[model samples]
Target: MKFDTTQLSQKTQTLSPYSRLPTPCSLLPLLKLYNKTISQIVKLWNH
Candidate 1:
């Protein structure tokens, strides 16, 4: 599993231009919330 820049660029070509922009710091809270929800779902399923 290796990807060259050309391959990645080709793949991203179909996506919106904004998709190549750097991730914003505001996403950290959303990612934390998503992880917490997934952990809670896993805990419920384990029981």
Candidate 2:
């Protein structure tokens, strides 16, 4: 089975709480963590 990661990007956009945008460098770590959490959830669902 193939995992669609594009959905992850869409989900991340909605899940983010910031009204005003921060610099990309600052957001990188938070985005990484969010993506990691999403990946873990997907793994759990696959099992």
Please report the candidate that would top TM-score against the real structure.
Answer: 2
List, residue by residue over 1-47, the lDDT tens digit for candidate 2.
78889998888887888635688999899999999999999999999
Output candidate 2 Cα RMSD. Answer: 19.2
lDDT of each: 0.85, 0.89
| TM-score of every candidate relative to the true structure | 0.51, 0.53
lDDT of 1 by residue, 12-37 (tens): 78586776665868788889999999
| lDDT (Cα, 0-100) at 11 in candidate 1 | 78
Q: Best candidate, lDDT-wise?
A: 2
Record all residue pairs in model 1 with backbone atoms less than 3 Å apart, i.e. clashing. Answer: none
